[model samples]
Target chain A: MTISQAGSYPSSKGIKISTVDTKEVLCGTALIKRGFAHMQKHGVIMDVTNVEQAQIAEDAGAVAVMVLDKLPYDVRHAGGVARTASVKVIQSILDSVSIPIMAKCRIGHSSEASILEEIGVDMVDESEVLSPADENRHIWKWNYTTPFVNGAKNLGEALRRIEEGAAMIRTKGEPGTGDVSQAVAHIRMVNNEIKKIKGIYDNNDDQELIRISREIQSSFEIVKETGKLGRLPVVNFAAGGISTPADAALLMKLGCDGIFVGSGIFKAEDPLERAKAVVIATTYFDDPKTVLEAQKMIDEKKSMLGLDTKNLDLKMQERGPTI
Target chain B: MNNELLIGVLGLQGDIEENIKATTNALKEMNLKGKVLSVRYPEEIMKIDGLIIPGGESTVMGLLIAIKNGLLDAITKILQEGLPVMGTCAGMIVLAKKSYDKIVGNKRQLLLGVLDIEVERNSFGRQYDSFESKLNISGIGNDYKGIFIRAPTVISVGPQVEILSKFDEKIVAVKQENIIGTSFHPELSGDYRMHRLFIQLVTNWKDANKGHQNF
Candidate 1:
């Protein structure tokens, strides 16, 4: 049925019409960019390589999928320059799935980010998992309309990325290892620092706050805002080595707004079951019984053979700029 | 506890915190005694006077809720029994009886199927085409910021649904009695008028259903 025929109101007859001015319809504003990331909060974002993988992620209830040329584990094994996923594959995945599709660009690679944005990818990740394109600088994210999710090891990198217009932040845990230790450490470190800043702000110690701001290399205002909010200004997710339902739940319990699973699901013996299990664990992070049920959904023997962060030759988390 | 309103933002996925914050602020501004929670469990879903399904991927939300065993049924039953609910953006897609993508075509996901509307997902195109506008939300008033982010537009509604707001003559907001659905995200906006209106609906629903409280 048509609007006027089915509904009670007859096509704008009794509707309170404004002057019918063409209100400026603005896109890619900061609110729009940041707001897009907010919609992904409390959800699992999985890494998918092809159309089939993308569809699997969608079937498993991933809020979004991040497309990559190779999963991080395979990237580590390949040990070469990993660029964005092929245009054909990305396009196919985008066309195939109704959920938001994200693609990761090399650190400091503007052209790659621009290309992905041009293809209408929902979000871009200026990720360190891919080989670094620049040694000294990360891409200035504010230059583009496409929202970016940057990884951070501590509070400094997070606020710096936010200052550079990164709409979302995730901990740069040791990628490809499948070990949750580094991810746990990074989020805990970020949370501990936020606690410290909140304490300084609560004490009305502007001097200490400014000193801490300089130390972290974040803007004083953003630092103060972080302190006031007692969390990152934007959504913070845990990424890199998340591999199990318990791993996902632990990060959520540690205050990650959501999760980004890379090599976690696909590398497991039962990708579908593991993916579904992780989504459930993340959704009910605070509930132990549900988490336990999720944990049992997958066999421990089927999990990816994890590497220790200390033994890795190429540490991806150390790729981005220290300052 | 009896007089206080307990509102919930469906926590399966997407913008749960934003809705919680918006509802909390609306409660404070209106000086109402209420508690807003991020709810996921069926038991939790049964205890609320009102619920908000936040913006995210509607496919993911529907799948997650359905997998939770009886969660979708609980939400549908509550809405049918006069529990006030507001769905925004992808949330609006979940509330609709039918939804299809403008490009990829028909989807096969679980839906609450409570709101009597057919929604066209990504009707304004992809994320790159997402935009913001000033709309006259009939009940909430004018110049309301309508942030449409890869949003849906209601193609048509049944006679029971009341069209509340429109942009470019497309249905962006509709109310089917205790249930309200919007194509734009009110939680993302700085304005709390829409949320205030939702809380008002919740308050009135609670008053009318007095001894019939599900909790």
Candidate 2:
């Protein structure tokens, strides 16, 4: 019943918490101004344990890093069961980082997740929907204090996560398969479905109810309307399969909130350079102007080994919760 | 006696004073009596023709009402006689027949039991994870702002109940004959039209019951 932390304090750094009554919602650009607008900085979600590789992302502009089950030098695994790792790994990352840290888990591994929350990890993911080795396991329960970011194989999967308390959504491509199309298709589907229901669902509020319902459906359309699928996520990005800065630019064009390059950077020859390009691509996913400004870096070829699907531990395959 | 109608606001807990201030201020603005009385006794139930159960943690409110002398029995007796009641957030919770998660906490918590709905506490996750969104409500002309803080969602609306509104298809509000329930709080805002609508229900009921009382 007790949360570890709450309350706000003013700092000399000029940070302030303006309390907005989210109870009753208004329509139009106000929602855009308040809810979905500020997350435009395409977040970087790094899922590595080695501090060196982790720093590559941090330096290259990843908004946050995800500490994982296998250390980079372990050479024994790529990912693990709903987060089957030592608690100390997560604890160390919490100690080492100032930015947010993310961790992965299987559908029912909520107990482990609770431990991660205790470590103060900022976000959690129910991964494996992208991993080619396992069947999909739907995760509706996430027992942790950190906000969740789930993967969507398609639109229905995405909406279900939103209904189940997930704060962020991303498209899933088969990890280790070196494919970006699945991620692209998934993003398109989510955008279209939300637009259709936006107005119909918007109008049906009951007056006799105590408080007025004051929120509008989020504009998933912003992601769909954008032309390219190889996107740089700026707002709430969790779409993976960004192999290069070009791929990232496509996602930004597709309106992603952030980027998750599980294998894209680590598997690449120049993890640092690729990471740098991705950071630039997401920072300006839109404004042909900004992406154009970041174009020089976007064109550079940084080859990644891609996940060697055949060599991956077959036993490690498992389905994760939806996005 | 006052030309304007009188309505009781259940001052149990959660967003109690907020609802009172909003409802009272609304009535003042409308030039209506709208006496927003804080009723904790069965005797108090008879004073106001209508009631507003503002949003709150239901379990706590139920426990408190259970200890308030004969208050629980009084509420049940009044509801059995068919009084117009509107419950928001936790208030809507107390109106239901049963709640979820094996109903932990103290045994004193009981409902007035007017509606047949089954409620699940924290159905949409815990309070910090609870969200506010605009939802379509019946009778209200526009979208009512739904503030779902530690809200109780109606898992199953019983036979006599009418489903009111939903978010992502989850039932967030419901109504039965004289009792209305919502998962969100309306009194938290400046909007008085919904409060006005409930008052009209009470006024019309009082007007209809006057001749019957004399008989």
Candidate 3:
């Protein structure tokens, strides 16, 4: 029977398929959430704490704003439990900006995710930058209708998140460092792993593919899909240590679909100009001349004093599961 | 064999890729040859036979159009020149003569003012209130899934505008001249009927305007 004629069939918990056209099922399908995430491609998602900051981000051309209780660097320095932002703050940010607003919940904090979803936040980031509420489990994201983004340092970690129903993935770079080294390293590692998997898929090594899937703890279908695509099934953005326009452009050049600025924007000496510059750089990432022009938009000394990732006492990137 | 049509999706912001994919799929299903490109620069808009404005943040999109050098003027000129354009969700908001967000108070956004209609942004309440329902578009067949996510609703239409579809008795889709606006997202609905309709509109326009100096 055709998909349209097949009648209704039980699928995933939230999703329902009419079996009529298997490819055309609409309601809670991965396509809808992925399509939402794809909307933010080649754009910047800035972290904003208040209505004013959200306004600044929108004016500076941020495609979306991440509602945070404190900047990532501040979270790192405070050394306390960094949970999700209060409903009040999120509501204010939502009211202040017409652009999409994303909020961060502590890893494994599904309650916080539900709250944000209830309040109508566009997306939620199960961010590692926030203190982990549960070490053994990340949010079981498929249970919610709102799309989610999670961080990963390698292909296996990325696949695991996708398996958990993450609609978007970003490198869990050492956030708030201002040094892009960790972000770069994570992105390269994931890309290299994808290349290796592609090689296995090209050889039609089903057993090896199964072995890899078992090792990664991700489903075989998703792992094989990743191998075939030579990349994560979802949009891969670079997050964490992005500070300067040059840094943002560098990540885009390294094949990230987008960049997320956390402590980078508001912590800089000139946030307004810095934010605009980073956006311009991201948009014209392939043009060296335009990147240079964007680079000139801000002063080096005025940028947030970047921390050396190697010297950091805590590495948020290492917080998430490896396999 | 230079008879290929180029369709452009406004790439300034929003759900651009999905629209591109949907349009491409629509073209393929129709057995038509067409190239889909994301239009960022103003000059790029001049080369397309048709245009699509995908859903996103209407206020931000308007700000970008206002700031982008010559983009607003370019779009206005093209619309006046009878370029076939489809605006979905926030895109529909951008094409309206007037738009208001009740939650944001009395402030009205600067829009293309090309389509003579008034739009209420986020008329469907919050994001959680978003839902999908089968719609019977005037031209397209019934049971076309229409996805509404923080969608706008057309409150009023001008004499020239033709209402295509409605949900809950609210105007959700319309057409005026070469422009079409839908408060729901066709790209996300996994149905390419609306996109197919737009493609057909583009092809017809191309045929009628063949060899015309200003396309």
Assess each prediction's global lDDT (C-alpha) against the native: 0.87, 0.55, 0.82
Candidate 1 regions off by >4 Å?
A1-21, B211-215
Best by DockQ: 1
Compute DockQ for each candidate against the true complex.
0.47, 0.03, 0.30
Candidate 2 Cα outliers beyond 4 Å, as residue runs: A1-41, A70-82, A129-143, A199-238, A287-295, A298-301, A307-323, B1-215
| TM-score of chain A by itself in each prediction | 0.93, 0.66, 0.92
> Candidate 3, which segments miss by more than 4 Å at Cα?
A1-29, A321-323, B106-110, B211-215
Candidate 2 on A161-240: residue-level lDDT in tens?
54444556667654544456666766776566444444333443233111211122222332232112212122245454
Q: What is the interface RMSD of each candidate, in Å?
A: 7.1, 16.8, 6.5
TM-score of chain A of 3: 0.92
Residue-wise lDDT of candidate 1 within B137-174, one digit each (tens)?
Answer: 98778889888889999999999999999888889999
lDDT of 2 at A48: 70
Question: What does fnat come to for each candidate?
Answer: 0.68, 0.06, 0.22
Task: Kindly list the per-residue Cα lDDT of model 1 for residues A251-291, writing each as its tens digit.
Answer: 99999999999998998899999999999999899999999
Model 2 DockQ class = incorrect
Q: What's the residue-level lDDT of A238 in candidate 3?
A: 95
Candidate 3 lDDT over B23-130, as tens digits, reads: 998999999998999987778888788999988777657766776578898888888889899999989988999987746644435689999999987786655455
